[model samples]
Target chain A: MLRSQFHIELNNMHVELDKMCHLVIEAIDRCVEAFQNHDLELAQEIIRNDKAINDVERSVESKCLSLILKQQPVASDLRDVSTALKVVTDLERIGDQSADIAELILEMDEKDSYLMIEHIPSMARVAIEMVTSALSAFHEHDIQKANEVKKHDREMDQLFEEVKLELVQIVKENKDHVDLAIQFLMIAKYFERIGDHVVNICEWVEFNQTGKVNDTRLI
Target chain B: MENKIVAKNVNLHYGSKHALKNVSLDIKENAITAFIGPSGCGKSTFLKTLNRMNDYVENCKIEGTILLDGEDVYDEKVDTTVLRKKVGMVFQQPNPFPMSIYDNIAYGPRIHGIKNKRELDRIVEESLKAAALYDEVSDRLHTSALGLSGGQQQRLCIARALAVQPDVILLDEPTSALDPISTLKIEELLLDLKDKYTIAIVTHNMQQASRIADYTAFFLVGEMIEYGQTKDIFSIPKDKRTEDYITGRFG
Candidate 1:
């Protein structure tokens, strides 16, 4: 309680980061839904809202810089500020990947019939769950939850491979299906990259909690 | 590195007030070890003990073994003058003597019976250069020490301490009274000095400790609370009390 003003500013920064996490999570959710139902309007909305996540990232980054310059936090306070700075990068990238998926969904031909591919949606669901859990782990400071998110990434990778093989089979069955299959493949890859971003976020959560990244102490 | 100074089960009392608990730590050879805590935490009291500066305090009682180079410093037969020469000290303020700068640097050597003028001049020049103050004041060596700026005076005090070529240097808030640039110069000088002398500092500035110390010890209420590598202590301190203090959450 000694540095109450510093604590207040640090808490405000945490709140801003939390808000950014929520925005990124929503983008992932809405983009997946838009991809599944072929809702062009919702896809456009998610793409537009990606800017909000970027703005929050910039705001949180500025707060962290100010806290470091003015308060000169050390120990866990230092770790928290550094982790926030790194986490926002991953969160912003997650938002970008989600927006990229929405863009790919918008590029789908109206008569493509690729929406029948079940594995792509499954990958999207898993990616969304991993992202939610990773950010939650950061907010809650739960290393166990962060580790679980890391483990879940393997499942995401497997789903991506399945989607790739399924699309390849559809293209082999009919050369005319190549265009739609390739678009679906690109969407699955975006989800896969989102999974990687979630893993990075989880790593940063571990760093905030334990001051280590991938079992190596950074300080 | 080897243990240049080892203090074991050290306790001190000024009359009925226990100023230091059973403190024990090793000052590594040729490395900067910083002691940090809030005011009146006995960090300076403990620093004074290293050079037996507390012997002058009335009603002071000390119980411990302080070893310097494997020899007990408190042993009755140990010459206090020689022991003091081996463990020189600097105070919080820039306490330069009211004499010329050349005499201030030459005072300790003169006391130790070095009367040769050429030898004294060499010692003065080497000490000033070692303290990183030679270039600015070499031409004004005979000028009064008090006329120097606050930062320059502090470094001159450091030069005075270095004139005798002590094996270890103990500083208590050496830069608290100076400007930021002066503080940084002293810090840089300490970093450079560690190659030839073991250094222990007592400071209230946690950032200063983190910046220059190879090792850091946190003291609290006459007790040594925690000690470790500076990186580990500042990043992931094992004790919550230490974490609270370093993070400015301690009341």
Candidate 2:
């Protein structure tokens, strides 16, 4: 290798990004579990762990800046570093949105049966799968897999619409359930946003692979 | 943009050793084209061929067609002196003729028989201004060219090249010997000069190539590996060797 130190530093950055992906994925998974079971303790734990994801983002950002300053990477190396810089922002947002869902879970009334709506949990499951698949596409450098993740977002959006309609029906039947329905709506919206973040991550993956986003060349 | 120089199937040999193998490309008019590769990759040899700088080498054999403004550069009827006047060159180091700065810029015009003091003075000032060095050295025109900083010397050399009114300027690693600020000044000067003169540079600095070059060609082991727009060449190179070379994975 011509630039062994640069390759090592780039590899370390990739490992850190992989770590961040897992951290965000775990936060989303646990937040959904906490929401499904109304586990306040787990929800609070997820919120606290969000700091770790943010710290990883900071580490990746610093490493990227160092690579750019020290290595002056070009071609695919430039794309890789720039994509990592962009991917971390989306990953950090995914972490924050997961924490937001955990906070919403904490605000849910104990007597409410919003979990019975069913589609919200399904949305959470699809969101987690989308995030996992998207990061896998990133780590694998698979554009086809990234495209698959994008296709999965459509399923997430569909589930979100179903949840929105179900919540509206519940609120229409009984005005007393309006407060809990709003909470459920917020939770579904968070998952939908997570799906969007996963899609963004996939787009970065495509850029890392092809140097284009949505058919537009960025590099 | 029209092509200022077109080279087709150019091959060169220094005795028995092949230096450049069938290299071909177009140097666009009023644009910067950068040739880049590792040392011994024939990038410099190829650049030298554009101006026939290799004609002095012993046992050197060249075969190819090189056109400057649609005229064959190798035609026996062509005057090399006039060819060189139209195709000026600057070297890697700032080889300012150990004379005063004013004389340095005026040397080319003087050699071409422009002896009128007023005309030489006008050419000196205009070339220095065109090179972005007039403000720094206008008061010190009589100072020794060697006394200037490395970057200033390089710009002075460029000014000397420009004093002759060349249609094309060829720079061989123009900023390799300078500091960052000087290098940036040279880069900015080249960017500005591209509006009037065609520029072909052979650079070891890939960032400099990506920064100022509108078109880039990557050479490897005497072969032209890839050629394209600077943005695509630096972002998503088509050839894997070009990618590996640019990304510093291997060269």
Q: Tell me, by DockQ, which candidate is best.
A: 1
Tens digits of per-residue lDDT for model 1, B120-146: 999999999999999999999999999
lDDT of 1: 0.92
TM-score: model 2 vs. ground truth: 0.96
Candidate 2, RMSD to the unseen true structure = 1.7
Docking class of 2: medium
How much does each candidate deviate at the interface, measured as C-alpha RMSD after superposition?
0.8, 1.3
Error at A172, model 2, angstroms: 2.1
What are the per-residue Cα lDDT tens digits for candidate 2 across B1-251? 89999999999999999999998899999999999999999999999888889999999999999999999998889888999999999999999999999999999999999999999999999999999999999999999999999999999999999999999999999999999999999999999999999999999999999999999999999999999999999999999999999888783
A91-177 per-residue lDDT for model 1 (tens digits): 999999989988987888656553567787689889989998888888899999999999988999999989988988988989998
Please, what is the TM-score per model? Answer: 0.98, 0.96
The residue pairs found clashing in candidate 1 are none
Worst 10 residues of 1 chain A by lDDT: A109-118
Per-residue lDDT tens digits for candidate 2, residues A1-219, read 788899999999998988998899899889878877788999999999999999999999999999999998888899999999999999999999999988987888656554678798789889889988888898999999999889998999999999989988988999988888888888888889999998998999889978999889988
